[model samples]
Target: MPFTLVLPDGIQYVGLAFVSTIWLQIGQAVLVMSARKTAGIAYPRLYAEKAEEEASFLARKFNCTQRAHQNTLEQLPAIYTATVLSALKYPVFAASALGLWVIGRILYTSGYMTGEPQKRNTRGGFIGSLCTFALTCTGTYSIISLALAAA
Candidate 1:
């Protein structure tokens, strides 16, 4: 016997959106690397050794850029999982949410790169959080629906 898996329609959109998010993450990492070089920060040292007051503006900016990317990495696993799981039942909605999440992350990175930590909580951040919450709820609903249908 052979095992065959059936995928829902519109799943391609979800896949494309997911790939876009990955590309966005890579772009953020590249920006961090560029900032690190511009700030003269070297590898193995996560941040500047100098005090905040003593650090050059470029150094401070580098730290913020790095942190922005780090925050995205921290959230990626959950976002990816929810995106895929939710697509099982609502592929279009999942894709749209993922797209919004990517846009929000871009805005969040832009604000954070300004070297003002507080600026990181921009409308983009709120949009991203909302999308994540929506995806989580949809994913949970999808799972329950599947289970109930099987029973």
Candidate 2:
């Protein structure tokens, strides 16, 4: 359409990255902290019985319970790094990438609990994973595209 859409592209991209980062932070907080809090509240007896490492022990003990949270924690690095690079290269796609990663992560958590990692991600999880992967690749190619365009 036009060269600029009211705002400069770089500015827009940076702003979007900030918002994406916030969302990522919220997710991290939930996986790292809120989930633990929920575990503590849900299993008062476990906490009482094993005060030391109650949460850790409880999470480890329950099948499908700890795995979900652990999965989210595991995905944080790949997701965040992809988002950063995507945002820098392509803002709109970066947001989409972040959205996909979040959705994939949630599905991954559900899948972890179901004992069938592939099954749980059937609907949204698979799509989200695909989107995240696409976004990551897009971000990588975007850099090359920009360089080639400049050259």
Candidate 3:
């Protein structure tokens, strides 16, 4: 056999981190679905659009949950890209940061579920932002370094 695949050390942790993100996304979706049911929101309505005074508390709560999940979905592309690129040269750090980001998202979602939008700016959000920044920087550096070395 002439073909072989050699994965970087600590790739397992990176794989686990990716799996955790998948589960986190699913969990957030489930929460939003449950909240929609509680709020009596019908299908195809993205959110409760009534005036604040007219909207029921449950409806407001459901909107909050939905927004939290949507926000997570928006961030996933950046998270996945940074994770994969950074893992090529810094698998352990990349995986660690990604793991923290997942935890932070969970906390951010829980806080947002309280129906107080301000609560969404929790420590978890800060942590997640910091981790994303680190990952982006690391991934950029890794790619540039690899390219220069190949030249």
Pairs clashing within candidate 1: none
lDDT of each: 0.90, 0.57, 0.91
**Candidate 3 structure, TM-score to reference:** 0.94
- Whichever of 1 and 2 has more TM-score, that candidate is 1
| Predicted candidate 2 versus true structure: per-residue lDDT over 55-145, tens digit per residue | 4543433334354555555766776676666666676777766665666655655555443446556635676678668867976886677
Residue-level lDDT of model 1, residues 46-108, one tens digit each, is 887668416588888899999989999999999999998899999999999999999999999
Model 1 regions more than 4 Å off:
50-53
Report the lDDT of model 1 for residue 91.
100
Residue 87, model 2: Cα distance from true site in angstroms: 2.6
lDDT by residue for model 3 (1-151), tens:
6998777899999999999999998999899999999988888988987774156888888999999999999999998999889998999999999999999999999998888888888737898999999999999999899899999
Q: Quote the RMSD, in angstroms, for model 3.
A: 1.8
Q: Which pairs clash in model 2?
A: none
- What's model 1's lDDT at 52? 44
Model 3 CA deviation exceeding 4 Å by range: 1-5
Ranking by lDDT: 3, 1, 2
